[model samples]
Target: MSGSSSTAANLVRTVKVKAEKKVYSLPGQKYAVPEEREPLRIFYESLSKQKPESEMAEFWLMEHGMMSPERAKKAYEKKQKRQKHQRMGTPIKAEISKETSESSRKSSNAKNDQRTKKRSLEYEDSDDDDLIMKPSKAKQK
Candidate 1:
């Protein structure tokens, strides 16, 4: 019963407030809130079409409450870096890994070849005429 009476009182106050305003307003605020802005992709798209980045960044900052001008500046700097990379071209991870793997494989093969050559040379040196060996125990006996 008390809940219903409180609800009635609240409804009456809202009705009185609505009478002064031409259109229905939000419960707390005066007007309907605007929707959220699009992502940075849209800003980048606009940028490609000759839109000013700072203006777009300001608009983004307005929409994002936690964002600051400093952060926006940093974001623009990163975008510039990305554009530079795009212009210079970037290698894919797979291509980099493949190149590294091929070079390492070549180096290992070269080292193995060198080791085999050294071993063969050592064997050839062992067969030299001046080579001498200690007598076996049976020979000494």
Candidate 2:
């Protein structure tokens, strides 16, 4: 029983040492890219050439040490702006004056009020005309 307990104690100590070592080593660990691999280099180079404007190309350049992280980040932001502009189509050059904007808002509010009044009148007329009769409980009995 004593021998078993001693072995268990040794196992626990080894596990704790391993856990501490892992925690300490994680922050300082740097990832080493396999630069010696010709196929991977060629693949990334081809991808970068094919889609120069794409995020994947930027990532490939950054990962392969061809572009710095800061440059990649700027390129990514520019790409995003370009795509957003493309999606939004042409920008309107005409600016509305404050007076015109306020007038338009007032006119729109008036139109909405008129529309609601018309809708309520139509609903009232409809309710009076379409009377759905329900059978009385006395008739059922």
Candidate 3:
């Protein structure tokens, strides 16, 4: 069915894949694409070579150059700035923590109020019984 008729969407998908493959290929480099390259695993291994926080610095140095300290420092600052901006404009774990704390505090306050109300009712009932008994005792005397 595909030999004679292909949809425009399929054609576009095919073209996009070919373009992506070309973009990923190295210029003037002649080698078959490796059959099994786990890029994510490789990245994790590279990061494992250093501490997690320093991995970004190591990557910038490797990609740019350790020899260029100014460039490295600038890149690091840029990376940090981007990270900070990203964090500034979004919900993070800290927000979740704060929300959880607030909700717990509200629940605890509600529970305490309920306990206080229940205690007040009990005291009122006891006071009413004492008042009634005092009147009866005085009349009997």
* Model 1: lDDT to the true structure: 0.55
Best first by lDDT, ranked: 2, 1, 3
User: lDDT of all the models against the reference?
Assistant: 0.55, 0.63, 0.54
Candidate 2, residue 71: how far the Cα is off, in Å: 2.2
Tens digits of per-residue lDDT, candidate 3, 1-141, equal: 675466754566533344444332222222333323556435544664665445453444334333245544555565566679788895334334778899999999999999999999898778576446433444563
**What CA root-mean-square deviation does each model show from the true structure?**
18.5, 14.0, 18.6
Q: Can you tell me which runs of candidate 2 are displaced by over 4 Å?
A: 1-11, 15-33, 75-141
Please write out the lDDT profile of model 2 over residues 1-141, one tens digit for every residue: 789988988787433344333321222222334475568767777787896755665655554456555675676565566668778994534456999999999999999999999999898878565577777677563
In TM-score terms, candidate 2 sits at 0.32
Q: How far is candidate 3 from the true structure (C-alpha RMSD, Å)?
A: 18.6
TM-score, per-candidate, Cα-based: 0.24, 0.32, 0.24
| Position 128, candidate 3: lDDT | 70
Kindly provide the TM-score of model 1 when superposed on the true structure, using C-alpha atoms: 0.24
